[model samples]
Target: MKNDNVILGIDLGTSAVKCVAMSTSGGIVATTEAAFPLTRDLPGQAEQNPADWLTALELAVTRLGRDVTMNAVAIGLTGQLPTLVCLEGAKPLPSAITWMDSRADAWASSFLDDSKRQMMYDRTGMPIDGRYLAPMFRYHRETFDNGVGTILSAKDFLHFALTGELATDPSTAAGYGLYDLDGANWSQELCAVWGISSSLLPTVRPSASASGLREAVAARLGLPSGLPVTVGCADSVASAYAMAGLDSGTVCITSGSSTIIMDSLPKPLRDSQRRYLLTPHIADGVFGREMDLLSTGTSYRWLNDLLGWENGRIDIAAARSQAGANGLLFSPYLAGGEQGALWNPNLRGVLHGLTVQHSSDDIARAYLEGVQFEIRRCVDILAEDSKIERVVLAGHAASHSATMQMLADILGRPVAAYHHRSPAAIGAALLAAPSAAHSKQMPTDKAVAVPSQLRADYEKIYRRYCAMFPAIAEAAD
Candidate 1:
């Protein structure tokens, strides 16, 4: 039977645009996905067309095959953030500079110094990488004829596309590395340094704030013209919300192209590891500590493509391999610009202990293990809550049994995967729910128990992985 009360949740991810329709009485009634391309046309340049996101979103919603006009009470959205979505009014000027791109490094270096970087970090709750809004503003400022009018993050762009409103929440705003973390507003001095006028920044609002959809957009999408749209948050915060605990007791890991380990923090905090960022959670007075690995699934994909295997898919070959992958070790930093502990933009991925007997399968297993080791490393730095036992894992990359079990054995804690396919999208739906404080739908139940057998071997290999980073990074330096 169809539930009368349903909400549409959409997330714009690096690999695809995902939608989950949830009923108030039932759990997730329907889910849909439409894959989109994230291209690297040049080295250190990751680009995506905003129009493609819109088309993919429409297709996914159509695939849901639900009567949004009758059922969907509200629409909630979330997306990858700090994405430099350069816009003139509602239309994108050209390619959106995604979070993965590092082309703004040259401008960042010229504009920021040791003292200045720390100053910006204090204001933004993160150290500036080339990915932030300020660097993008400075780097590509001269490329446009009219000059870039307004820069918005992925979720912010989606909101504007739906409601014709230019606004963002603190979660996405902080990702730009120019948000006043203390003031909860745009940083005027920081914007001045990057030649970004504060006037161009969107109006900041709390996540879950509401607006009515534009009539034209609603008619085109086959929805009610004045349907309520809840302004949602960034992907990391959404993943945290899906974990079902917005307090200090819960920890969530969103493992995708990048690995993001987040914990609900009570107040504003910073880690000694400069790359570990602090951002406001969607809920008021809640904060999140996010430690990110730039390339987790990206490393896996690269290895798969290098061997000419099926792309965008991981197989059981990794599980068939031994715990240590025949002594092979990999550092999963192939994509450059790591947000993890080292904070090194030039850090390169390394593979050690390859032998003639080792198969491509062993290498694949090593790649998976390598990313897990980095997760353990970053989690140790960002997680202040010491009494935690397990991590709630979302995102497809680390949700696999082999990957989760390896992570469990590595971190010596059970890994709980969301029963639902798209927890991030579900989190967005929660934003639209009447009670954002609770969920009527579901709970995270697919917990991957840690096997004691793999611990001894994994612990030894993990040490070697950690030990090798210094020598390899030094050699590159």
Candidate 2:
């Protein structure tokens, strides 16, 4: 007989809430999604109301309740990391400071000294970025009164709202820039320097362990009271899980609002160059993953908006016509910037080699290539040890184009796309299911793209692009 109890996975994304219920056998019994608007009051400000997330969560669970069994075994929650939310006695005081927001750049620069910052990177495996919690915390302290009760990320706040639990998993805490990657805990010294209180932060927990559900929340969702809720992970980590735990020498790529490249390591790997971030795996002490975040899909969206593409309707024929793009090149740093080079908030988008001969198709193709080039840079940095064996691509953008195949050829590696449409939600479901302790079934993978025969053609173009990086950097300077 099938397991009577089901596992529920809730993903609180930047623009949507995705929920899934799964049988112990890894079958998806029910799935639901609800979307909310991401508001931008100013050019650099991206904000979302916390109430919208709560509403979406309620709606998604209610939608799921319409079809499937209600005896949920456990609930696992995931969300975009580093977005900050301030709360006063469980009430949100302001809109969430989204991960894309760059308002804290000056604040981050003011508080984090160079030596201390390097120590932080050594301890946390994360380079200093304005989006991290410590920077935003400093911004809040300088701008707001100290009386505000606590500040939490979007996921941590949602976890508390659902189960009255004040806790975070290592996966989410890793993005805070204060959590010690080596120590596997929040660094009191770092927090003190930023004038943050340790008491305001949630307790760190294992990503898959039980977080007892609260009665009030249970009644609202029609779930059984006292049910177990798994401590959730960062959405990227959850996606990694859904694809399959990073085996020895494997990497995962997710192209969303930003591009995230992650690879599993047997132990914490600190880069003296600080090219990428290392964080504890969601699966406890079993592993760690390194991350590189850059603006990839955001560049695509920028082009679409510029060309008046409505409803995500892209002219596929036009896009393909300009594959080589007549030697056009673009630097996709539209929304601030990230990664090892030029971590500048002031960096703007640039389109090089533009001329009257170049068409919209050329611009579009160049945009795609630009993003792929950035991905290749990160991959090269992470592959220094020659440990990466395979590459798995996930996320909506990865599914949308032949662009990924070009990326594979450029990297000289085969790329496989997993079947799971929303890997993060699927991974959340896997995390929620305690049956993994007793059963042997695991998530499966399906390939959507592979290495193209035109590897040599793409390589030539890739080298030309690589050769242009120094010039591009100089131009940006």
Highest lDDT against the true fold, candidate = 1
TM-scores for all predictions? 0.94, 0.92
Runs in model 1 with CA error above 4 Å? 311-315, 384-386, 397-399, 436-441
Where does candidate 2 have its weakest 10-residue lDDT segment? Answer: 437-446
Q: List model 1 lDDT by residue over 1-477, tens digit each.
A: 374678888999887899988876537778999988888878788889899899998888888875643578889889987788888866886688888888887667667778888888788888787888778767877876675678888889999999988999999999877789889998888888777788788899888898999998887777778888877999888878877557685678877778788888678877544657889998777888887888776776777788888853454677888888888998877877466777777788777888899987888888878878888886766545445655877766444677678778888777777757677888888888777424553577655656578888778888888888867776654
TM-score, cand. 1 vs. native: 0.94
Evaluate model 2: give its TM-score.
0.92
Residue 66 CA displacement from its true place in model 1, Å: 3.8
Residue pairs in clash, model 2: 249-389
RMSD of each: 2.1, 2.5
Cα lDDT tens digits, model 2, 284-402, are: 55454555555566656666787888624433523464445688877677777555344555556678788998877777778777777777777888788657788888765455546
